[model samples]
Target: MTKVQTAKDVIEQTKFFHRKLADFYDNLSDNVEKERVKILLEYMSRHHENLAAILDDYESEISERVLDTWFMFVNKKCDLSPFFSASINPDMTAQQVIEIAVDFDQCLLDTYEGILQNEISDEVRDVFRGLLEMEKNEKIKLAKNALKIDSM
Candidate 1:
């Protein structure tokens, strides 16, 4: 049976997801030969790490009632396996890395959107809505910064 998850559970899982993405970028940065790609990977790694930290703070501030609000219908979609298993190599270009980063961000955006679709209390909904907005803004910022990096 699929596990029913609370808002806290989802937040924790997403925090872990960001940390894993950061680690993935860090590991790739170490092996890449191109300076531009390494710089982009390092930037992406820091972005994810920052995002995870923000989530950690968010989790600490949210009330237990909202955090404990369970969602029976929301399907878990935070799987990072495909990203981890993808055939990313040390020879990839900065553009290629940005594309992968965008894809990863899109996956996270979709996950939040999916969670927001289920019936939820207003407080829980507001929490997710805030998270969704943050994800959207971050994705846009990432794209813009990555483009500047690629142009250099």
Candidate 2:
């Protein structure tokens, strides 16, 4: 991946990644046979869509002043290429699907955490913090929902 430079660049990259995630979930929903699992995947897909939109709004609201400020890119393995290549078979259990989703969330959270470790302007830090919080909340929600689905 190309080296990220500014706060806006990071946000733009994240937004692109998130849109890809939304697409992944949508594809999973399409491939899954179980109605409940399908619904869950669709909900997650929508959640990712909302996340991308949120970042887009942030990018817009963050003035060029902060957006253009240089921020060091922390080299971390944040690629979702493995997920993109994953085969979503209809026979997979809801638990298995949830496991994959949770892993993906964790990977995202880790990436944001890595970003936080880097030197950045206060404005950029705040943006990253908000993104981190959102990821955390999403992970918790995913766990809870996964539990409900597992019990079904």
Candidate 3:
């Protein structure tokens, strides 16, 4: 790896915070109905896996700070949207679940891109950016299905 300067310190700290951010979403996998959020949650887990890898390479302080700040950041920023709540109700259509999943995936992708910009390593950033692109493609693929179901 190229010699990272002060940027390494900040990148490591950001990775730490993001790891917990990734972890919180990991926890959400168990929170809802089957076929509702499971696939989206799985996609989220991939990003968290990346974050965890970064964490493993970082020093103690950055890791610790990320663990500490994750909770508050999630509480304030995460959104369920009208799309997601519909998935939980029995009367709602299957298309709603697709919509929710697409949005959920998009949110995860957005965060990945944000983190990529702050990353010190091009290797790390490329991994995250690739994942973000994957998320977007998945979201698009799911969107057509969602609209198809709505028409039924």
Candidate 4:
């Protein structure tokens, strides 16, 4: 509640970190790796439920341009995966690629928490909190299905 950072600042941080996470996934080269990234992306897409809540809380006076930018950031981040590179093609072992992705995901989650924990807004914080926890859970989910992905 310190009112140090503006809601705009909170919005921007979340936006920046979200894209970074997508780009991080988009950087992987191997086939298995891409699948891992894809899985993460799909997991993220499931987040619409939480994100809608935050978006609803934005000021009525805010311009659609701001919302558009934020939405694009979300869309890009949730859908990104580096495995699209025709060269990389995701061939690594499931265990290996997912581990790397998880590290970056953790960083993404931490950045989100750091920015969101501030007094910016509970609406914003709630979404970040869900994302942070989901990133942690994703590692486990991938691990559980490692063999399935590896065989593919």
Cα lDDT listed for each candidate: 0.86, 0.78, 0.49, 0.47
Candidate 1 residue 78 Cα shift, in angstroms, is: 7.0
Tens-place lDDT per residue, model 4, 11-124, is 555555555544544444323345555564344333322343443454344554433322112211322243333234455544555555555455555555565545444555
- Among these predicted structures, which one has the highest lDDT? 1
TM-score of model 3 vs. true structure: 0.44
User: TM-score rank, highest first?
Assistant: 1, 2, 3, 4
Off by over 4 Å in 2: 79-81
Give the clash total for candidate 4: 8
In candidate 2, the residue pairs with backbone N, CA or C atoms under 3 Å apart (3 or more residues apart, or in different chains) clash, namely: none
Q: Estimate each model's TM-score.
A: 0.91, 0.86, 0.44, 0.40
Return the lDDT, model 4, position 55: 36
* lDDT, candidate 1, at 119: 81
Q: How many clashes show up per model? A: 0, 0, 2, 8
Per-residue lDDT, model 3, residue 145, is 50
How big is the positional error of residue 57 in model 1, measured in Å on the Cα after superposition? 1.1
